[model samples]
Target chain A: MKKIVIITGVLTLTILVGYFFQHKNQRKLTLVEKSDFLQAFATEIGQLWRNADLEGDQLCKKALNVDDSYYQCHPDYFKCLIDKNLIDFRMKKKKVSLKISSSYKSIQRPTHIEYLFPLKVNGLYDLKLRLKDSCREVFLPQRYYPFLANQRDVTIEWDNFNKKVFVDRNLSRVWEVRQWATKVKNNIVLKKLKELPASDIAINLEIVEMQKYCSYQGKHILSAKVYDAMSLHPEDISSPEVKLFRAPYFPWSRKNTKTNIFKIQKKQDITLTEKQSENLCKRVYAKNCTSVPFQSYSSLSSTWMGARETLGGVMEYVTNTVHPKENIILSSKYYPWSSHVHRVGIRGYWDGEGRSMNNFDFGKYPIQVFPNSLDIGFRCMRFK
Target chain B: MIQVLLILFTFISCNQESWETSLQYDLSSINKVNFAKNYLNKGDLKNPPNTWLKLATFERVNKKKCLFYKTPYREKKGVLKIVESLAGKCSAFSKGRVYNDNFSAFRINYVSSTHAEKSNILEAIYSTGKEQLALDIPLINITSPKKYERYDNQLDFSLVPDVSFGEESNQLLLENGKVCHGVNSECQEVVGYKCDKCQNGVVEVVDYNCPQGGSKYCGPNKCGKKNQIACPRGYKILNTKLNSLCFEGSPAGFCEPGLRTYCNEKNILICL
Candidate 1:
């Protein structure tokens, strides 16, 4: 039998070359070795407002050195956990060793990378190809290290290939990364938006905070999206916490109820009357987010403001660079009645809910292009 | 070192696949005088230098029609030399003197061609490298690409998540007024300072917390902490802003702590 097909092709090429040299020499990043290169993501209080002078969890303890003191107990690095709302880290670990010269110096502070998978998860289907040939062996050497980490201004995002790991100026950077990006250290930009000359996309561009009028009727990433001034309720403010006003949408059924927009959150048209929206859906929590009662509009995710969906079965781009009119909006719009930063003057509350990852205009001076301000977006959804 | 091994062999021959969908030009000089009048003709070239022009782009080869040149290698002031060739042999890189020593990680240089009046010669070399690299070192990222993605894009250095690195003009050392142009480093705190009066976000220094406590006044652009209302005597703070709406901190009438929460159901006494 041809010696049983040459010993099953020499035991599948010696277990795929000894499982790629034992996960490239026994994986160094560990907690208990789960290797395929260890993937990770955690950092949203809105990505630490990308850097409008960082406040909340200070851009993830300065990009993941995590209040350094020498790896804060390094097994291989990454454990993090700041949590007041979120800063969680752990792309399974490995990459701490620094001293600067000796005494563990370390404070040059600036390292916020996240994704570093390099391959070797039992040969992902034992190298039988396809999974875009095992995602081009971790993004074809990251398309040549994100243009040598962008000629040193370093922003290396071959779409977080090898999962993620940007750690500027200490290590784990791409394209020579020495630190400097995020629109040059923290003007916090992502800009691309340009088109302007609307007859009526729904109309609204007040600027300091108002724009989001004609609901950019999407032809792609979800169309009928709306989100009203997120669960309004200032009712002419006095505060016991605005006496509690969560409810934005939900009707009948599991009943705890919450619905209010014209009756509060001041923009005015005045609609609530179902016993003044049930005396404010009996105070607090509220999450069904607008299905009519007084909602003249408030649909996109409803309140606490969030939603734009359809990153179609979620993300996949290592230069697929897909652009169904790419969205994720929210650059700045929460310091008015008080989330803080309105005239963009600045205090705290670092850009959360002000949303936008790029398009500039927080304290001005970035211009090359920035016309269209709010269309309200936020893509990427697949979790299944 | 031979332009760092020809830029590390043009970054490992940019992992092949015909340089992944070519077509990346940033030509400019009237697209190199209409690509030297369509592929080196109309007098095989000569009429480029306003300052300089040897620059090339717009390739074809095989269906035949070329001009890809971009070769310059002695690089390293912060690296950027690119060469990659798969027979499309990337070329065109010339200069006379304009090197910007870590001018925030420089690499794209070509100076010599100017004025034919705006077709955006890389936004006039990125506004002359942000008015000459905003006082040198440790902070240089301000790309300009756009006009059909500027020849495979140039003008995206990335990083501005709360801008820092100016222990004196955001360091690599070189301060004393740190050029304050592309600001951040010597980066005089502006991180989103909006207040021009009701445009609202102000902060050069306005320190916090007033959950009903007073006297704390930060400034440079404006800051407040208030809480000492004796005005029932002659009444001032401008007679409570000429008929109260209580615009200070404004949770709209805050004053909790002790005495069972003094006046908040809109009776508005907000005791300080």
Candidate 2:
């Protein structure tokens, strides 16, 4: 009975083991079958990728499919490529680059990078720019004349700029774009000063006199004197009749070249302080000294040979500089106002008078003159 | 102990007599299946004097046994069950091909015994019904033709090869019908005929196959790039220039201008 029991047990165990192993083998075979299917699919996908010539939609599809099939193995690489390619394709349109530079270092700082903008079919466009420069207010001592003459050039260039503009990180910068078309249409008048004739050497001088001054109807006044040439003596001259009779000239002493007539005119009296005198001259000649607009009498001499000819009119001279030709002078009635001026001899006649006179239609002022000027006595300050 | 042995001997003799009596009645029954059953274990019998008894039961059912009666006799039930089994065997055997090997020897033994018994029982039970005979019952035989002989007789074996499932179906039917019975008309004309085998009592019924035609299989032949691989009949292929100038009848049916191409089936530019 024990033998029977043992024999039965062994048979049962054998059957059970066979059953278990058979199922295990079956499972392994099933896995192998599935792997075969997957392997074939992978091969086909790889072949498609290899055969695909251009890297475009077809390639993208094939690649995506390949990666999808085997994402577990190469997720990062394919993901990055797909993302980068997508971005690249999205922005594949042509773009135009612009850089900007200034004509001079003093006019503008250097820009190191270029900017790009989308291109359009019609290239005609209005560009706007707002840039920062240490010398925003350019004292082109040269541009000053025509600037004062109220004249401007076409195609004024902004410097330190190319077709491109780069923002500086080191400085407190504020740059902007503006419509050059509209901005250029309007004139930019920086500052104004007197423009002296380039031919006659001008000397800013001071004069003092205590002679007997006379008046006409108390509304006009002048220094009473008459003199003969070849001698230099103030009181040796004869006295003119009307006592003052508007001094030497009436209304305006413009283009009055009487120095050859009277040697006693070597010295004249100045009537206003330097500050008051500059203001007076500015008021009188503000329009004539500008190149932009509202200009008055202009001398070709002021704009000759790229030289800066600055002129200051004062009733009193603060410095001991003398004038060579006080050929024309300006004096106002009932007021201590005098403007040392020159009258342009056009057709041999004084067309206008005072520092505000100009031969606008007559004289051709060279384009090279610079009309930069200072108070010569005031303090100069530089901004931070 | 002696008395006990005598009693045991007598008991054995009586049991043997009873077993013999049961076997004799089973062999003499009108149902052949009962006879088959009796014969299954008859190899143990010691007698050889049963020629007349065997002659009385030559694979037939007795007319007198045709009467309907219910009884709890094991042999009678066994005989009926065995008869149905035999009928199955007969059908299987009837369809056997000549060159086939391994003819299911075990099944043959089982079926032959059951079939003989079933025929006998059926004759005994339905002997009262009038006999019906088919006037033109078909008889057919098929053999392989010589290797050198052309197989042109096979309708589907053509140059282009009836590349269609339906056409193949029709050809198979024609070949089968010609081999087993015979066809009355051209296979193509009668190819669509399908007899309802599920409802019909006849074992073998007329069957033809459907024909092959239409774009269901062979699609439009002239497909070009960006064109529909298939189109409705009478319509031709059309190629469209995309980008600024759109092409008509692309797979998507319309094209648009852009850096994009191949809008897929919808025929629109795909934005990245």
Candidate 3:
């Protein structure tokens, strides 16, 4: 009886020890490993969210046998997703995995799985969630867990369902193809324009300046002064008695006398008002012609050589306006002699003056406009 | 006994899954010259791969065929002894081609049997020594024109006068009593000179011998009419206006000679 009891106790002890050892040896997932898995899961979810719309469109096309011309595809899109089970997703903590439904026969699974952890979805998290909401409405009709929304800030170990998730490379390929098509279209337009005969009007390539300063909207700009033909002749020097007086040469000569003539004389077009100047430019150039904006003018002046007398001189009229009755004007860095003086009872007022030219500041004070005063001028700009 | 067996089994499994085989290389056995030649022949210089070996050969030395490769890792302060010992083993066959006297170049052939072999070669080269070349090149000073300076006119300064009246109409006029009509005006005829209408209260007269042989003088009464008098002093009619009509497209205004005046907006003369 004593031997039997001792043997039974020993067997129980041995079993307890063996169980402890087995549990200790079996590797429980660490916090770091769980975090890594969550990161990869988030990345896969992001990719799936992004491709959901494209996938829906493709599926709708296949089901209805219609091209993009067909407008009513929303109902068909949802039906296609349901029919193909493309959005029938199962989420868990153990691993994130995806399998291309039989509908996507062209997409093949990658041989080597990339476990890119700590995926950077810094600024795109909200956008992805919004996309997921649209995708969720179609696939998951039931309410999703609230904790999933806050997963970025919190790490929770979900039920360990053994699965592997992968992002569909076809989604990325579709994106690349669309991007390439746009780039090719732009290149073709540029090539056609370049192949045409060069215009006599000096078109300066301000691509770098446009990209840096003008928000990449314009590639080329008119280099020669606007209303160049109306510029005063260098020989028409105004005496100090008529220094304040300004006017274009009589009958407006078409010859460009100001091209190589930079004298101390009053030059540049100062006769026309803003509306008149703009109309004149539009009439001559026809399209893509307008008064030079302060931004474009400042940028061009900053880089161009011989900008002072050619691009500057006089309070040049610009497109920017501060008041209803006033428009902004720019002057050359070298020549600040044209002061913005105003008289109260004049027909028009000089609204502002940019004396320094470098700071790009326009004065807000209204000044009188003399009938013969020709301190203000404007040049037109052409855009590409 | 059961617990001991479980622990051993667990350890063996973990070892099989996690253990990585280290790469090994015999430096002496590698033919440095042949490796370098093969690397260059593979067009690695033209199209380089993203690797430490390619990065090394990216910097081309001026006036020299050799390339300077810099190690990515920071050199330790006390590794000079080890560097010297390793550099002593660098073969003489790679002189001037792969390395100079100061720099020890390692030719890492990426087209080896396996990725492990390439990594092994990279590791071997890294263990040798870190060499740095200090360049004392002068900074290029570009003399850009002053931004605020007036733009120089392309016109020849020598040809331009300080002050010019620019083709005065009087300079083109013939001397008094000289025939003043038709081509060079060498004959006597009724000479007519347009009056300056802009001069408000001025008058002048010009006496000329006509083809009929008697002298006739035109005065202020003839202003704004046919056979108008010549402009008085300080007043002149623009040749442009003489050839066409009076200022502002009006033909009925006239004035004496040598009078300073201008046309008003109303086509009337305003004396300056």
Candidate 4:
């Protein structure tokens, strides 16, 4: 009886132990299979964005549009997901539950829709807004005007420095016979013929007498001598030097014959002296016309109201003087032959082949100018 | 006599129990042994033995805990066993003979007590004593460009997924073919999917066929053809080399013949 009881107890204990291990192994295998299924599901979810035809659906289209605010909780969007078989949805009473089921045993895991469909709507909206902002045209004020029009217009009166009594009524049509006589080379014979009664001959001889002292053979006649001869003999009008101090003609110049000289001379021949420009500005515009300050000449538009030529205009005299004998002058425009002494009317103002506002040498060397220098002109500034 | 027989039978059954049940109640012991197995599998030791072994935990001696384990051998005497000390030396204990047919396939000299709790005993055992076996799949998390949030232009648009695992000792899986692991993983296969635009001409549509392409829907802008209009939104001029006028952000260009075209991330156009 004792042996049988011992055997029975031993057999039952062995069976129990064997069953426990078998059950444990089976549970472990099931856990491993469940883990593998979850892993596979996770991998599929990761690739679902690229694989699923979310673009084809109507609900997804509205949600993805950056302009539309439909991405935030649309019932149709969840319904679309259900229709596509991507997720399983349950609605009990007012509560909604979303689950993602795996292929193994239809085991489902509760899922957040946000993680599954992370639409980049906000990012797209931001990108669109930035792109629109980038395309906007920003207005920059016109910092520099290359060519500004003249502000005000005024008539200039001629300074008949050489006062002469002429028998010809047409002062406007009077040919500058004195300029021609000075160029004749043999003026000694013409001086002898001055006492004759012929009016043409007397006019020629008188003009010759005024210019003969002003001429120098192969030497530059300083503008001071011309000014001195005219200022000393203001009534002597036959001195051809009257053209040297004349106001320049602009396209907008008044066509009045009495105030302007409608002569057939080169446009460059029409110029004003430094002193003449200042005096004319004061007399004609009735304002203190000072030369643009040497320091502020380049940026004259900031303070002064006037148009300046950018490429080709007359050079103007400034008030700043480098030496007792030399004064500063500014040429706002570019001149191709700026270095030519005859054309510039001043020596050493420009030194290169072409002088532009950008490449112009400022105050490299001071310029020597008489009060009535003929090559440069000046504009009158009326203070605002 | 019957009571004596019952007590003796109980003692014998307990002593003859399997290793699985022996360590089942002691989870810490099971974890320690599993950690040692992982440490050995990670190539910390050279020529590690492959045979199964049984674990035996020793009481704390001299303020140090130790684990002793031995594999079955054909010889009865002089069976070698490994003693792993926790935070101390295991050389003080005298070697003893322990004969067990069922044993765990793991061996280690030392295992820190702190690391024992972190090891997944189930995963270690599931790998079934195989060398270089992948234990757990890494959990993926998308950290940037939060859902419904705009991407900053200042930061690069990174498509790389972040992967994380609980065990620090587990080796990271290599990405090849369909499965991508981390930032360094590359997808060699190109998807042939094309995206279409809506009738409004502004919004991009991912569908191949526009569902709203009826009279109400204006067709997509015709681009990449000679004398055609500029490319629509989300489509960039592909033949930029041939058409120098086509530049980034500039909506001018006609695609030249036999040149490739490309669409932005939205896949609004097909590159042909």
Candidate 5:
């Protein structure tokens, strides 16, 4: 019995010792294998970067040397340049910057940076990003990187988080991306836009110089949103393309020349038979009116032909032709028609849709209609 | 003769009891061997002698509490018996002895502090590492002490996925690919892509396409073809080897200056 007990104890101790030794050795081997793989990985990539630049079979030779596996793994490295973004390419020395303002009285200063190529200017880039605020106030999209991307009209998004450093992720969902695609690269246009009041969002490209009121042809035309113009068409213009129009007048003859506004005859009110009001949903008319049919008064017209034309012809024509016994208002819409360097100029005609014909005389002013000019348009403003 | 036979039977029984106790528990980490003896005397833990091996498992009860146990050894059906609680104890390793049992395995059960009643049991029979074993212990059993469970746990460099080294390695290299911001050594042609009729001296640089109508344009090999250049987007040509005797008898289009189109190959040019 003693002999049997001693044998069992000896066997158990020997088995446990063998198991411990085996487990320790396995762990050591695994560590060694992992170390070898890591060292190889580092060495291969290091060698890949050593060759200044190689293409085709030459480049493949180096890649193959790194590891036939690496070349097999990434085939895109040696493909065509167009479809590929050339993410691993050289960059230019130039860079673009951005500036923005918020209605909350807080102004974000513009940031400047050096530029790189390929990514610097390709398709209109987007700086899609998100920033959390303690308060839940909704700020305008103007305060984001998308706006800056569109402002620069470049493929490079020089996006910075918390206003620190720029990072370019290939994010295209940002608002500025669409605008960047649509934007025309005009440094002068971008410069003029930055100088205007922050609320003026829409920028018009018809007018070359933006100020109080841009004069075209022999008449003066006020600034307006792109939608307000008669012949201004943003859809027709290709990306990175800007067309300039010049008026045929004085020093102001080419004021909005670079712009694409067209002249159209203003609409006059019809002496409607009450039947036309209740029966016809939309009246087809030959003339264009400043106000809609059911409105009590004609809305403000963005068309201006110098101070003389506004006080003399446009004001008088609206009073006599549409409303003759109401007050009038003129104001500019916020932002330019396009995202270019331009001013906001909209004129409002308030409650002036009735009779005041005999009070104001027309013989005291010189009147003229701009026919060949294609840079004139009008918008309506309402009265409280 | 009857008295001698009785003494031999008593000695044999005592030897069996001693062997069973030794196989059942090591009791090394447990300070009081007398306490283990008392537990055995109390019939809480028992061991039968002449067994090949007995499986012992450890269970950690709560953050500071754990238990070690001994069990009958069956190939896959060994049950553990609690030997001692390891909570509030030192981090000394517990070693198990393989008794006469042919198949024996170690298992660990840990009860988190947040969950006193629930305990997580992890078996070490088929697992290779402790991490895998911990994972096998279901998340439902790993009662997190605090309400917040942060995932800020960095990737374990040791257990990095094999796929990461293969696919992500190239991605990392590309992302970290440094640009030679110098001039002359770095020259990039503008508007050099897909210009069928090269305008403004912007020649229709061949974009690494197949010269043969049927063959597709493979990577970076645009050699010995008229107007053939490195694919615009695929590669940027830099540091030209203008006139070298390295390729004396090569075709006019083959290995020419600014046209050694070998895709992604590395070399220290010996401009002989």
Candidate 6:
């Protein structure tokens, strides 16, 4: 009787072990893993709810698609059932029963609102009502309206600037393109325009002035835009459209810019104090500079010259800085956007410590970066 | 196990992306830029006319802006103090071009700032006494110049004078004579210097700038030197004669009166 019982136990154990291995090989996500994903997604949605960017949709789609293939049949993650380049979404008020922890630790609520996404998990599709209303404002203060200057009816005043082109970047020479739009005979016309064939490509930038004894005027901002010419409306800017439109973009300075809104004339080495570099951001956005972090290397593309370094990760490049000098890199800590930092054995701080933990693989999705955080610095290049 | 998980979390959760590494360049399919017929074709993605770029290594201070660029010797140097008005369109344009790789040729045009705001039209600012057109270059070359020899960015256009001008009018009398008719007597005609090096060079003759009475320049190369030698008192200087006639005075030795003589056809003295 004992021998017969042992044989039966062995057969049952083998069957259970084989079943677990088959499920694991198929890359199925457990119920707990799915719950963790929803929790993290609720956090990103919190940020998306506040920031009013012209291209805010890109962020929403990026957060959902990042590290998870919504296509090609992956069993471990939820798949965005839709197959389109752009992900169009809007928040809904409908409620459904879900087991989700509150996103906001401050406010307690009975039911959370439904969040719609173009994703499918198992037999589920269309919408996910499993979110906590845990949204809170980060450093960015919500400006009601930012006044934008898109109207060309105002007279263009005098400004002196030479339209000259040189590739902008460190250790690389890249071409610049600017498409100037003008209203002629009540029709849109582009002049001296050269645009690349790509999807919504632009570099966020800001321009500030440093005079010997003067407070300069004029708009100091440009954001990524589409189908419209850049306009200048000076001061009194407080419209949501203006805030989105007036965000500074760096590539615009290098391209075919018509209006000379600001000019930086220096007869010597320009050194801005830490307070001044902070002010540079204030002048452009008209907001507290702390809202925007330094910069992100993930925004690059395959077009750049040093394709290897740009893709491999600039954090690695920053660690190996013999070119830009540590002080120039720390100019943001000072104002006038100048002032050099003497490297006396201080390499500064890292975002999340661990020198060897960076990933060199930049697949289809770009690495996410928050502009308002640390790793704040600028890059200077020698032209080819 | 807990310590291992903590280390992994720190390593994977890297944040703070940077713009210092974001590439700022345009990309085109790997094909040589088309410069057919030595002109920037409209569709050519590589090089186009009026492509302007400004690159500067910079630093800033209290109400002070400084810019640095490569010096003439190719060393980086700072030489600009940027003072600016509130941000707006940079309408004040100043277009200039170097003649060639030698950097020998230049045509600069400065748009009138005040007028640009009102006229909505950009016109070159030219004053009467200032240089409007350069001479020593051909009219055709200046009016419709050739592109730079080696570089394509060098634009080809004449320097627009600060003001616009109408076509040449025939109403003005030429030195050949306004009308050499019998009725027109002593018709004063204005003779203009036909500049051999025209267009890229200029020449203007103000009657006020000309010498009056007694001394006169006769050849293309005038005013050989300052003329200090003058006829003595009571003597008149006459230049129409083959040699200068210093009348009312003795000719150093002997000569006839009225049909005065000092030297003949071969520079030999003869009495008439």
lDDT of 5 by residue, B1-272 (tens): 33544564454444332212332222211211111232221321224422222222222222222233334433333333233334434221343222223223333332234341222222223232233322122212111212211111111111111111110001111111122111121233222222111111111122221211011111212223333432121111111233321232222112223345332222111111
Q: Which sequence of candidate numbers ranks them by lDDT, best first?
A: 4, 3, 5, 1, 6, 2
Question: Ignoring the other chain, what TM-score does chain B have in each prediction?
Answer: 0.18, 0.16, 0.12, 0.25, 0.18, 0.13
Task: Give all candidate RMSDs, comma-separated.
Answer: 25.9, 48.9, 34.1, 38.3, 29.2, 36.5
Model 5: residues with Cα > 4 Å off, grouped in runs: A1-32, A46-75, A78-384, B1-272
Best by TM-score: 4
lDDT (C-alpha) at residue B15 in model 3 = 35
Q: What are the per-residue Cα lDDT tens digits for candidate 4 across B1-272?
A: 45755665565544443433322322221211223454444422212243323333333112323334333334321122334454654542544322232332333332222121322223223212344332331111111221111111111111112111111122222211111111111212233211111111111121121211101112222344433332222112121222122233332222334433443343233223
lDDT for each residue of candidate 6 in A1-384, tens digit (9 for 90 to 100)? 788767766665565456444333223333212322332333333333322132423322343212111111111111121232122332233222222222211111111112222233322432232222111100111122121122211221111011111111221101111211121121111221223211111211111111100011000011101001111221223331232333222212322122121222122444556765543442322112344542221222111111111111112112211111211112122222111111111122233222221412222222244234222212221000
What RMSD does model 5 have? Answer: 29.2
Q: What TM-score does each of the candidates earn? A: 0.20, 0.12, 0.16, 0.21, 0.16, 0.16
For residues A1-384, write the lDDT of model 1, one tens digit per residue.
Answer: 888767766675566556445334222223212111111121121132222223343333433212132222221222122222233333436331211111111122111111221222222311100000000000011011111111112221111111111100111111111121221332221121113211111112122111111011000111111111111212322322222323222211112223243224344455656665433322211221133221111122122212111111111111011111212221122211111111011111113243243533333222233345333322110000
lDDT of 3 at A76: 32
> What tens digits encode model 2's per-residue C-alpha lDDT throughout A223-291?
000000000111212331111211221112222343321121233543444654333343333222232
Arranged by TM-score with the best first, the candidates are 4, 1, 5, 3, 6, 2
lDDT of 4 by residue, A186-299 (tens): 566345444532111122222223223212110111221111111121221233333232222221132323221222113345455676544333212111233322111111
Which candidate number maximizes lDDT? 4
Supply candidate 4's per-residue lDDT for A127.
7
Which 10-residue window of candidate 2 chain B scores lowest in summed lDDT? B134-143
Candidate 5 lDDT for residue A250 = 14
What's the count of clashing pairs in each model shown? 82, 48, 19, 11, 81, 87
Q: For model 6, how does the per-residue alpha-carbon lDDT over B31-135 read when each residue is reduced to its tens digit?
A: 111112222112111122222212211111111111111112223221111211123221112221111121111222212221212121111121123344221
Error of 3 at B38 (Å): 2.6
> How does candidate 5 score on lDDT?
0.22
lDDT per residue, candidate 1, B1-272, as tens digits?
Answer: 33544554444444322110121111110111223323232221122211123333332212212333222223422212222233543433422122222222222232222221221222112122335321111111111212211011111122121211111112122122121112122223323321111111111211111211121111111011123211110111112333333333433222322211122332223334
Q: Which residues of candidate 4, in runs, are more than 4 Å off?
A: A1-14, A21-33, A49-60, A64-84, A87-384, B1-272
**Residue by residue across B154-206, what tens digits does model 2's lDDT show?**
11111111111000011111111122222222323322222111110001111
Error of 1 at B1 (Å): 40
